[model samples]
Target: MKMNRTLFLITLLSTFAMQGQDSLVSNIQEVTQVADTVKKVPQRYKVEGVAAVVGDYVVLDSDIDKGYLEFQQQGVSTEDITRCQLLGKLMEDKLYLHQAVQDSIVVGDAEINPEVDQLMQYLTAEIGSEEKLLAFYRKNTLPELRSELFEARKSLKLAGRMQAKVVENVEITPEEVREFFFAIPEDERPVFSAEVAVAQIVVEPEITKEAKQTAIDRLNEMRQDILENGVSFATKAGLYSEDGSKTRGGLIEGVKRNSQYVKEFKDQAFSLLEGEISEPFETQFGFHILKVDKIRGQEVDVRHILVYPEVPQSSIDAAREKIETVRKAIVDSTITFKNAAIQYSEEEDTRNNGGQLVNPVTYDTWFDLTKMDPELSAKVYNLKPGEVSKIFVERDRTGKASFKIYTVTDRKEEHPAEYVTDYERIKELALKEKQIRAIEDWQNKQIKETYVNVNEDYQECEFSSDWVKTSN
Candidate 1:
């Protein structure tokens, strides 16, 4: 399905955060738009209908409309932003960038390089190749385009920081939550599904100890050869690297900051300096040796050759047996499920946090069972609170299947949400309200503080979604 910008961003962010590792992956197209009023635009990149020019930045009409269409395709509702509203947004972005520069809010290479890679990939994919990219966009190479994207990275990071500031301090109380619930009428209150809380002892059966060692040995060999021969990593990567980016040689793609990563992969990739190669390393995906090619701003580019650790039948049996042992321990109450999770679970996020299940959509400890994976929902929803589940295997979208044993830590049946019954949920609503209010407060603060000047044409334009009012 075509995803909206917001949804796409959320998905991308979630993926990177969950894995917390490093390796180059695929990228999607990224673009921005705004409204401009200037007749003779000075910028080389123009897609008609001048949106707004914020100092050195210009928001084009195409940016907004393209995003609008994308949102529409995704069934997301966005009340059409008038040209002026778009301009306001453009101005806001520029303002954020301006503030970021003043504060020296530098982005990490980890964040910027992946984004550059994604954009570059998309551009090359669209226009044909590296040569075509230069010919069509009048850009010499990827680095020049990456420089342009660096500015975008700054704006995005600043906006994110600003947003965090708005919601970071806001807190919701149980009483405030009740008020929020009551504020919504019965018909308006969104109904929830029967939800389940599930815990898991995960087993990724991709790597056998022997195969894993082999991968390590190979990487070590490759690393030694690179040092001995001084073979360019990118040239080596293109010719013989086993990683997915073999065609591009080992050049790291541009990425957004705090974006998805393989937990081990990301950490190591971000830690390296320019022109350095990492010792052979291993992640859930497999073993790799990395060579850092370049660093721009806070983003880094690298190439790697991955050697997969062979999956063994005995290894699967061993993993399952371990899971069963944990299950039996839970059954006997020798350990609490959460504690067992913390002790034995390999899944990073939950294992570190006592195995509390979080809803992917709401990020809540609770979830709507209906929205869960069919196998998981069926297993988890049937269990009462504090029940452990049998080992079951599930496949990701990529057809990569893994085994996991789940424990239902919590369960809630269908019921009307009320002040007393859904106290926490109500509180969450109140907190969300506070967040919205905080945003408005912040926007008003910005308007009051920043040098904002609305165009004369937009002076009388009525905005339906006004966060702050100006004496225009």
Candidate 2:
């Protein structure tokens, strides 16, 4: 259940990289316009000055302003301390980018297109519609926005790759973890929260072959209506598509060939020509029919109508009955709970780990009681360690209802963190600190060796690293 911190860092880098020059300038302009309205000042401004030069890369004052504005928008106070920290992080990012280019790291469209599509989808949703988003950014279409953001995305992936290379071999031993735990001052020690470790045996409600055929038949009917009844595909999609984009006429625009869509969906989309409607196709989500509106090079604009098959009440009852039998076997000591989970559980991710539930944030088996699912927390509130709860139905993130049996393996009351009991948690903390130190050391060496020129304006600002040395 350990989280890959390196992957987390890479994702963070990609997000930062998505904030291209135009987007940053737009943000700054919005803020400036708001101020102008309040103070009755002119909205026009002179050119922004350079803040720093890292090797061959130049950091603009607008870049710093963009970072500052992002923090402010996030409700972070733009006081001196926070501002200095933000500036330091930005400088370090530039250093990574410059070094990545020097080291010949190549980031291709395959690595960037998916992230671009995701970001565009999020922004479009945030602004209520793609039309509104385009108007807000003064862009005529979504493709224009993607083009503007492409270089920044590429630079971000390069920086992420460089960071991965730096920390790929770092590891921590048990002794190191113990030493790191004891070294913390008593007052600085972390207070532990009440936590529980639970294991589950899950069985998904099965959709019968007949149910799948029913869904396929329904989709085929819709397809025939579109082709023969002179019904518009978008109109049919609006009336029947089960996806969130049904409100938008089931349209998805500016989708690249390499975007992270389902393989079936992408394959069908890329294979079709403009004004073509595909036959009903089955994907994990449901039965879907693709209508290609337009295709340009590797990108396409398309619409789809999805119809998910329904799981009958009998299927749910049968799954619940199956788990009840497994529970009985475990209770009668015929088989151990862990072995039962290994042999009979339908949940793939947790089955091999003895059906243990992991906290996504901490990536550990122990979950904070307050953060658990309301239904799950309520059920285990009174149960003692090693107690099993009765069979229950719960819907997963995707709304796929499943029957489950849960066993509370371990529980602990809130207390101060201890080396003996919290070794794994402490090890994770120590490893993170080590990784940060390693990155910092690398950044310091790069700053000393590379040519860094800071404007006098920023030279007085407090920096975490000595980027403006006398030699430089």
Choose the strongest candidate by TM-score.
1
lDDT of 1 by residue, 82-115 (tens): 4445445555556556555555666665555555
Which stretches of model 2 miss by more than 4 angstroms?
A: 1-50, 55-80, 111-157, 173-179, 192-194, 200-211, 214-281, 288-307, 310-346, 351-354, 359-364, 368-408, 470-472
Which run of 10 residues does model 2 get worst, by summed lDDT? 21-30
Give all TM-scores, in the order shown: 0.62, 0.61
Candidate 2, residues 183-284, lDDT tens digits: the string is 999888988778899899998879899998998898889889988999988998989987655655777776776776789999999899998999889887
Clashes of 2: 0
Overall local distance difference test of candidate 2: 0.72
